[model samples]
Target: MGRSLVRHPGVRGCYTAGNKRFLQLNELDELRMDVYENVKLYKEWTKQWHDSKITRKEIIVGDKVLLFNSRFQLFPRNLRSRWSGPFEVVTVFPYGSFELKNNKGECLKVNGHRVKYFYEGQPIQARGELELEDLPSLWDE
Candidate 1:
């Protein structure tokens, strides 16, 4: 003897219209539940995928970094430079806050996200001997 298929709860019969078959109300509900579960799984995967691509910047005190000038971005200009300073890092606080010192001896506290490591074409060299002429004075000439 052949086994009979059981109807879903509250579903009396299959729905059909114009050569297309439709799911019963309970079956449709099950499909919706499956879709919801899939959406949640995809959301988690997307978060992991996004985080995997992010490169965390390692910052420390005394490091030289360039601050991104967001103000310039507001007024879009062809020739305007958006980055300013190879500022010295004076302090580092929790959660990406950093204190920087500029050439004018002005100190500013800013978020780490706005700063990036300063890069020059060549590496800086430090010599043990101090040459007075080579050193820049604190006071402007």
Candidate 2:
């Protein structure tokens, strides 16, 4: 059910079959859901997460985090470009997600599942130089 292919180009996000919570997420497809789930949880709970285990906001104006460009984008990440750096939390939308910043500190709004904490071992990157550089750019500035 899981296998790391060499990665063929033009393969957008993924193609999942069913909704199996206990499904074997062995291949990258399985992990893809994880990314989706993490961001989703963040999206729904940004308010309650302000000072809780959320640690980071979904996409506030000034929080620092990461963003995964959709496979459909012109410069979308492949096996090589799938992951980007720690972006800033530019603005949090009423819908739940937030605007994000890239390594260059540019604003790019994204959903919760589309982004992560920015750290190793953890799905997204943890806060560090990446987030700090872009934090000041968050909303209400």
Candidate 3:
């Protein structure tokens, strides 16, 4: 009865089958590790590419700049301007911070990223003089 129970299909034994399964498990582990390493490398490359695209703004004291209006984002207006300053830069601090002075003589500290340089346009030249009758009266009878 014991001899009949020990029948084999091929020349390989039970030990060889167990050994092959062990080797396959080790190969699978190595493949998983390789995939993890490739993912990490891809993440680092993407971060470097994204960081390179950002442009750094150079700000200095006494420069005129416009402050970005973040409050307007909540109440959207198509015709309104989002930037609201020709503020003077009173002082510049380290790590992209600036102290700005508005027209009302009020000074506030803000991040440099929120501000951009304001470019002044050319002044308008008067073509001709107007008579007193042409001027609109402020008071009406």
Candidate 4:
């Protein structure tokens, strides 16, 4: 009698390659899991480092500040000044909003991120004192 090519002893099993492929697939899955864990760890470490370097800024009411002006009619030129105001802070909301008063007594509400503290001895000119005729006459068409 010819010996049967049985995989399981005494039970005549077919030679299906499923078991070998299953072991290879399991090994691949474990390798992928390891890579995912490493990426997660790297992201956490970077977040910690970035947070540690940031210093919180606190602004109180009555502090003098300069507002950053980003609005320009055309493409911005490097020579043009962008910082506009030595405005006094009238109110600072718990959320980052500020009420500012200029020398002309005009009040404006702007985001706190656009403002910075005005230090002493800075040369902020007195533009409020100038009359309409002293500057360009817009109505002379």
Judging by lDDT against the true structure, name the best candidate.
3
Q: What is the lDDT of candidate 2?
A: 0.64
User: Which tens-of-lDDT digit does each residue in 34-72 have in candidate 1?
Assistant: 999999999999999999999998989998999998873
Q: How close is every model to the real structure, measured as TM-score?
A: 0.65, 0.34, 0.64, 0.63
Candidate 4 local Cα displacement, residue 104, angstroms: 1.6
lDDT of 2 at 110: 65
Best-performing candidate as measured by TM-score: 1
> Could you tell me which residue pairs clash in candidate 3?
none
- Residue ranges of candidate 2 with Cα displaced over 4 Å: 1-61, 72-81, 120-141
| Candidate 4 ranges beyond 4 A from true positions | 1-21, 72-74, 122-141
Q: How many residue-pair clashes does candidate 1 contain?
A: 0
Better of 2 and 3 by TM-score: 3
- lDDT per residue for candidate 2 within 14-81, as digits (tens), equals 43444232245446686898899999998878957664764544334655566675666666445675
A best-first ranking of the candidates according to their lDDT comes to 3, 1, 4, 2
- Model 3 error, position 29 (Å): 3.3
3 versus 4: better TM-score goes to? 3
Question: What does the lDDT come to for candidate 3?
Answer: 0.86
